[model samples]
Target: MIIVNGDIVAQGSQFGLKDVEVVTATVDLEEVRSYRAAISRGLQAATSDARYQRIQTPFELAPEDDDADIEKRPTLPMQPRMHPVEEEIALSGGCYLWDYLRRSGTAGYLVPLSGGIDSCATAVIVYSMCRIVMDAVEEENQQVIEDVKRLCQYSQGVLPKTPQELCNQIFTTIYMGMKKQSSRDTRQRAKELAEAIGSHHVNLDIDEVYEAQKKLVVNTLNFEPRFEVEGGSNQENLTLQCLQARIRMVTAYEFGQILPTARGRPGGGSLLVLGSANVGESLRGYLTKYDCSSADINPIGSIDKADLKRFIAWAEKEFDLPCLHEFLTAVPTAELEPITENYVQSDEADMGMTYEELTTFGRLRKLNKLGPFAMFQRLVHDWSIDRKHVEGDTAPHYTPAQVAEKVKRFFHFYAINRHKMTTLTPALHCNDYSPDDNRFDLRPFLYPNFWKSWSFKRIDMELKKIEKKRASKGK
Candidate 1:
């Protein structure tokens, strides 16, 4: 029912109202977004009358009311203001999985659990799915029970007994580690986490597979590549690392396609594979194309690293999974490089930027829609030590030259690796800014380096001005 304002009678002809079917009163479309808050205020205003006649549309909600309309509007009780979406991000993620499972009729879910927080957060979300399923069953939600019985292939009178049992029935976690690159601590952490979550777990060393994959190039080029720690060049190091990373994707699909039959689940089917690449890494383009980032669906693709860590901490206490605390303290690593006494590969070190910085850069570029010059302009003051624009600021201290250099470096890596985003797995939408090119982010995979652009050249011009200004101030 479209409500047209009584005063705007002549203006109603402009909207082509025939297709709309109902145009009783007119409204300001701009105010529609705040309609919820307005309803709260209306309820507060009408607290005395018990027969609360709720206004159906914004057209009926006028700040000042005349006698005729006020007589028709019943008063409602004033209530405490509250938002129903406080836990929407985390809870809605689980709901996304459940919705997909029932609609698609997938047997369950499979995750390439790498013993990192990204994958760990994915596992925790699956556990939350189990919690949601059990809660539905306990509450006797008939529709959910019917769907559960069909998915689990349970006979009449049999129902899910616990979240752990439901998890084991629906979730499978595989840790594909290499003897040389994967460490004992990460391997053990994956095992402990799976046990805590009650997922069907598989653990194996893929050193043999890693070596065999390398032979494709080794046999063709008559070359044996080694990691950086093993005296290999940067090109050779990256080649070997990608070999290990891609192997995980191949293994995940192979297991996902056949796990139902192997487990004797009655119907032969496949599980929806989960990807764990966080938004910060996706933005930095710090992932290999078609590596483990390729999956049936990604839960953390849009969620940033800092928020993912906070979610993990929140899940540890809320879900009672003590094993998650270790992931919080553990250093973030790709674990593609060999673990050594002298060298442990850090994710931030490999990418040449921290996750926090990536978050800031991503927001400035996408959310703020700032290009190279504009981003440098914003960050110069934001990250400047001397010019603390906001008091009690904790941003990293950097000179204008340093800020400009960092900006150029980030856009360089971001531009070069953008091709990877074109294939980034479709992730759950939890964040405002995401570089998942396939879904939320839509941009060209190929482009000239932003450093060469006119806006970028202005950074150097700006830096020279700042330097000259500082030199004169010293006099």
Candidate 2:
């Protein structure tokens, strides 16, 4: 007997097939029997192969153990195991880029490789997508093969042999350097990583473009914006930095739209721009709006700083890209400011909190649902260090007052920059505490930048109580 399966319920409910007349059809019983017999023979041969026997590991009979021996055997409960977060993030981000490219029929990905941990992580994810496509082709995944062929515009039956070759076809890395904005070390690192990952690397200086923009702005405003080092006002300093960042975005899209045609490809398709902003920076509102935050997609948008560093370390070994080792130990910087001899701006310094603290703050704010006052109340103990009386001197690492101030500052910035989240590029939702507005997080964009009236009163009362308790203890 032969059995056939169909969506009978869907046909009856939606198409009124239930009212239609039932028809019977004759089948070729002899052909069906022959097909079954052939399938059985194939299964028998596959199971009987010596290679199958060597590969399979069946349980032994346990040497006919006695009842007492069986009772004495330890019973271990089954434990649930999850894939590593590193693997999950990498695979998800890689597949996201691949699907986006295939679905949109885009040429490839264009990443502004800044040599920072975030951008490096983005580049690695693109490389991972190349590896995934190559693996799929190896496994004879027809859909993947066809998508890749169409994406690269390869003729029929012409398949890529290696991940590197496929990556060269699909990925382009650009390093945009302005005058004195990017360091030699960072540029070298970007070049080395792109080479190691087999991406098409383009190094261009945007000094002229920046100068032209600056001149236009000066001509319009009758003043040239200067950096803080040159004794510019805070507004001027920020304006100058933002100009550089925005200029880079304009330049990136210009290249992304034309790089494929520039490389002599037949069809002119634009590359999808990839953003590299991490969750911690986004939470703290440290990123410039529409700068690096603006892109087609952000692979590491929901990822925290610590996890990104861990991912870089893992990628160094897994992808066999040793150039990622530099970012592992290198201090994270935006490099938007001039590299002066006296003052060098770091990401942490500008954010007023370490990445570790930022990670904690982000988790508390989103995962734990803690407001500013609540967060301050919790972090007082989390950040506090026990002070032992050593030679009659006691010094706490972080006092409650200090913790409260940090919490307040964090929330203030978070509220003010909550508007930026509305424009954030679609990010891979791998994190538990994502602040993505489109899906995971839904919060008001316009915030007062301060606590509500009642919340402020409560926080003030709490702070006063803590101070009183501290004063009594000190006495």
Each model's TM-score?
A: 0.81, 0.79
Best by lDDT: 1
Off by over 4 Å in 1: 1-86, 154-157, 387-392, 436-443
**Residue-level lDDT tens digits of model 2 in 401-453:** 77777788888888788777778888888778987555455656868848664
Count of steric clashes across candidates, in order: 7, 0
Which pairs clash (backbone N, Cα, C closer than 3 Å) in model 2? none
List per-prediction Cα lDDT, in the order shown.
Answer: 0.80, 0.79
Compose the digit string of candidate 1's lDDT tens values, residues 78-98: 333332331444576777888
TM-score of 2: 0.79
